[model samples]
Target: MRYEPISNELFIQNRKNFMAQMKPNSVAAFNSNDIYPIGADSTIPFQQDRNIYYLSGVDQEDSILVLFPDAPKPEHREILFLKETNPHIAVWEGEKIDEEKALQIAGIKTVYWLKDFHKIFHELMSQSETIYINTNEHYRAAHDTETREDRFNKWLKENYPAHQVAKSNPILQRLRSVKHQLELDTMQTACNITEKAFRRILKETKPNIWEFELEAEIMHEFLKNRSRGFAYTPIIASGKNATVLHYIENKHQCKDGDLILFDVGAEYANYASDMSRTIPVNGKFTDRQKQIYNAVNRVKKEATKMLVPGTLWAEYHVEVGKLMTSELLDLKLLDKADVQNEDPKWPAYKKYFMHGTSHHIGLDTHDYGLLHEPIKANQVFTVEPGIYLPEEHIGVRLEDDVVIQENGEPFNLMRNIPIEIEEIEDLMNQ
Candidate 1:
């Protein structure tokens, strides 16, 4: 791993919290993600499963974590099964985690190779009455590929027909939603890395520069800071391209007087930071551009203040719609009649601001959290609100990752990143 080692206490406490919610005599298991294959002998880069990484801090493939909190043998309560490493294998690939290193990383005393998994699992399963199986239940998930966890779940259900099965997704969704101090610190590092990239772009950007060149600059900053790359595919949309929400074809040269919408972030230690900023190509926003940019910035500020505890995700967006509606009316995008006669199902504000105002942001860009439930403190979210005017070839979005505090306003993780029009203009010119 390029990132520094995380303290095992985080994993230890995470496991303790998860176990506290488990049914008695239940055995829960988590598997690492598969190294998916492309065509020919090549395979995609390995990404560790978030659940296993959360519980064990083991960021390797072919790893499994079995938590049997009520195991008959005390040492068997928390076990880690890792891929066997021999000297020859170590020469082929870099050294894999040995038993001692696994213990140090995961804070679990018991470790075994993958070869011993079936035999030990059978014994453990016989002693337990229920099994907690991990599943991908995040709201935004739409994958068709079967993951390693899915395959393991299938085999477990087929072989152990009598065992009572429970879903680990619900428990994990709630547990992982709130930020731990260490996790918040790690996310801050990612945001700081992203801030560096944004500042680098501010100085490097000029009229006639190709969008791909700007992308390269951001990648350079991220790699120098020990980040693998973007948490998600970056959207470097310029001019009318900014109105297209997911535009990623960064091929055109940024023309003078056009605004570029940058939806990008860096990842550190598998934690994610999401940010969106719209800046001018020629280092200065036009009069109309400044007007729209400041409108989005004001909406972002007010929306962030609404992220306090007890706010419902659904209701919060509704309130943000009202804020955006007010801005749209002021900008002449909507008149009084447009607001009065608008359908409640899809308000007049939807014409200018289409997407949701915010989403949970952490390990994943859209991190796991129950939107139906009331908001709570220590929950980190992205406050992103935008207005896209295709006719004027203008789109403006300002976003920041914030942590909902126990009292008063939420804390901004990207507070240091320049957002004010004057600050951005000064930096770009300087």
Candidate 2:
């Protein structure tokens, strides 16, 4: 990991909170993600499963975390099974965490080698009446590939058919939705890194520069700041390309007067920071562009204020759509008659601002928060509102990550990053 080590207290508290919610005499287990293969002798980088990392702070592959608050032996209550390391393996793949290091990192005293997992887990199963299996139940999850957690779940079901099975996903979704102070701090670091990249690219952006060049500049800043690059696949869309919401083929040379839309972020300590900013290729927005940008910025600001506790995610978007509808009417993109005759299912604003206003942002770019539930304090979200006009070749989206507050409005994590039209123009001109 390029980032600094997180305090073990965060993981300790997370485990305590999760265990408190588990059924009595139940054991929960989390597995580390596999190092997926790309081809022979090559593999994609290993990313620790967020659930295991959230609870145990174990960031390596071939690791498992087992939690049994009620156990026969006190030492077996919380256990970590890690791959055993030797000098030869160390020489080939760098040194892995040992027993002492694991204790320091995870605050767990009972650690075992992976080879002893089945033997010890079977013993625990014999004592426990229920097993809590972790599964990916994120709202956007649609993958077909089996993960390490999935395989572990399958094995546990086959071996312990009599044990009552319970899902850990619901508990995790609720728990992970709200941020710990440490998690908020780590996410701030990620946002700070993203801010550095945005500012650097602002100085480097000029007419005729390839869109990929700007993407490269952003990546350079992220790497220099100890971030592991973008939280998601970056969208460096320019002009007409920006109209395509998920545009990532940054192959176009930016033309003068065209607006480039950047939907990019940086990851620090595995926490994500999502941001979107649209700027002029020549460091100055035309009158039309300025109008569209300010409209989107206004919508973003108003939408952020609605992210306070007790706001439903779905209702908040509907309110934002109303705000955008008003903006579009003022901009002459949507007539009063157009909105009055619009379908309830697909609002008139759908023609321009199609996507949702916000989503939970954290470990994943689109993090885990239940949309049906009311928003809560410490929940981080991205407030993004855009107006895309393919006919005019203008697309403007302004986004910032924010933390919902219990008292007043949501706090913007990207507050330090320039978002106002005047500030952006001044920095780009300077």
Q: Which stretches of candidate 1 lie over 4 Å from their true place?
A: none
lDDT of 1 by residue, 176-258 (tens): 99989999999999999999999999999999999999999999999999999999999998999999998998888999999
Q: Give the alpha carbon lDDT tens digit for every residue of 1-430 in model 2.
A: 7799999999999999999999999999999999999998899988889999999888899999999999999999999999999999999989898889998999999999999999999999999999999999898999999988888899999999999999999998999999999999999999999999999999999989999999999999999999989898999998899999999889999999899999999998889999999999999988999899989988888888888888888888889999999999999999999999999999999999999989998888889878899999999999999999999999888889999998998898999999988999999999
Question: For model 1, how big is the CA root-mean-square deviation?
Answer: 0.7
Candidate 2 least-lDDT 10 residues: 361-370
Assess every candidate by TM-score.
Answer: 0.99, 0.99
Local distance difference test, each candidate? 0.94, 0.93
Q: Alpha-carbon error at 67 in model 2, in Å?
A: 0.4
- List residue ranges in candidate 2 displaced over 4 A: none
Task: Tell me, by lDDT, which candidate is best.
Answer: 1
Assess candidate 1 and give its lDDT: 0.94
